[model samples]
Target: MVSSSSTPAAFVTGAANGIGEAVVARFLAGGYRVAMVDLDADRLRAAREKADPAGERTIEAVADVTDEQSVRAAISATVEAFGRLDAAHNNAGITSSGPNTHELELSAWQRTLDVDLTGVWLCMKHQLPVMLEQGSGAIVNTASIAGHIGYRNAAAYAAAKHGVVGLTKTAAIEYAPQGIRVNAVSPGPVQSDMLEASFERRGAAVRDWYYASSPTGRFASLEDIAHAVHWLASAEASFITGHCLSVDGGWIAQ
Candidate 1:
């Protein structure tokens, strides 16, 4: 049996809820110390309370993933708390609302790239050195089904996620020789708060159509994505790098 104390330390962003929160919980259960970062202070507190009832191996921070200073500080805090950074899940992101390619607002498009694509770049900029110094680490980035296929009124999101996949592959190649692994996870329609908000913005019928179209006959659960992330970040995936693992319930396959 693997001992909890022997598990490597991990840092996760967007960890206040949904898949991020579930990943934190799962990693903790597996005996790893984790640093959780989120933009929502109250939600972050709640997640900390629930995941680290004893506060023995978890640290929670409120930081904006899109801000360089904030992300840098959060990474610093993680190192401070955990003594070393062994793994990271850069999972914070936002969606675009019906921003079609032809009519997408420039500001909206820029914001999507800033948070989704550039944010991952910034996190990696700060995280890679820590891993390089240690000569071993793994990083899993959150992409989306949009990353692989173009969906109507989601041009900004698709473009940004594509950028994430591109970046992951590049970094994976650049640092693979240095004992670092970089990969990405693209999820389909999961029942997350992000989806709920999208439904409110796009209407129930459209959201229902998304759910109905999944080959799995239903949307993915948070745990489904969490489990995939766990494997990608574990020793089992040491040979996997520069790859985009899809946990989309065959959404893209079909």
Candidate 2:
């Protein structure tokens, strides 16, 4: 329930596909200006074509979330395009290198941490200044259910996501006094390209095993996660911070 006068601009990373794309669409539909950032230029363009046909207030930036220079430039571009940044969804991240933690290469582990954990830090590093200047803002980070619990072969991903939740909580408290809120959204198995790729690699039986374990007997949808993020960034959540909102279809309840 953000005030109409403060319908602020938003920046969303990893917006080329899946949940990121859905978040962009939801924000745009709510009449908020948005800047979408992704490493894949072609995919970003396609997402724009599908989500922001009018192109009235949508800005697209091709950048790597792991690269500080790219991220800084993208944030700068967002501010230049929209005048100010009032909200951000730091959703850009990569999966673990492989299924087996012990066998995973150091490079792979490092890459996951770089994108999933450090990337959020970099976004916050730049975003905080803008938000502080405005004296009001909200940030919703994309963590995973793995953040709270371990998965069999996803040690690196789980560790990195756990870091995200910790960072979100600390930042939330540090900035709450300044009228800035930071929160994390932990999604369970969601029906996204990420999950589809994992299914293709691991087979339907394995994927079905996960779905069956969920209390809801199903995976969450992109829109399901998007709705949660939208709520976290809205003014209705003004009193909420240092919170990890789970949109995991009862996966954690079990």
Candidate 3:
């Protein structure tokens, strides 16, 4: 179904904004059809308008990653539209609980895991089946530098991201023999509303901290992270699987 056209298609979650949005933009520019999914229906509409106003290549789907039924339907809808699924970016996630775990509520911890960790698994549960049927697919999950290191005051977020890394690796190994590739991109601080909101909640002016930690002396651009996901999902990184590619600005190097 995908080969019917000269271009391929991708199903991307968290695609209304931030890293997800950038990734969708990248794929669309490369002439790939995209199913841009997000929980916010209005934002999804906005993204579709901005990226594919004529509705020729990009379609919008509203779904919660935490809901299996919703995720399943979203993927199914993508296939119905694009004819086949060739790539997926399980990039839907959230962060909270601030920097102080002791101050973190049990509810917050559960919510974090339900979304940031379980959500990714829920997506792959449905997506992998489609890829298995097609006998070829590429998946790139969004991870974080926090997944590799213990970041203070973000116990729930860190734990969930660490789980994402583990899942990415395990899935990569399990699915590679099936003509599928699974990988992850771990990014450092990026200039996004999500990160800005985190700093706001802490009443923390963290520009200097992000700058100091990065030898590059700046936060990662969203485009940088998007490019990593694009390459890993494309034929360019055919041999790269079960790998956690870090898009951090030398944060993990320190």
lDDT of 2 by residue, 115-160 (tens): 9999999999999988888888999999999999978788899999
Q: What are the per-residue Cα lDDT tens digits for candidate 1 across 1-254?
A: 11223447899999999999999998987778999999999999999999999988899988988889999999888877776788899999998878558898789999999999998999999999888877889999999888989878888899899999999999999999999999999999889898899899889899879978988788899999988898898889999999999999899998
Q: Report the lDDT tens digits of candidate 3 across residue range 50-134.
A: 9888989988899999999999999989988887888899999997656488888899999999999999999999999888888
Model 2 bad stretches (over 4 Å): 1-7
**What is the model-wide C-alpha lDDT for candidate 2?**
0.90
Score candidate 1 by lDDT: 0.90
Residue 222's lDDT in candidate 3? 85
After superposition, candidate 3 runs with Cα above 4 Å error: 1-6
Candidate 1, residue 112: how far the Cα is off, in Å: 0.8
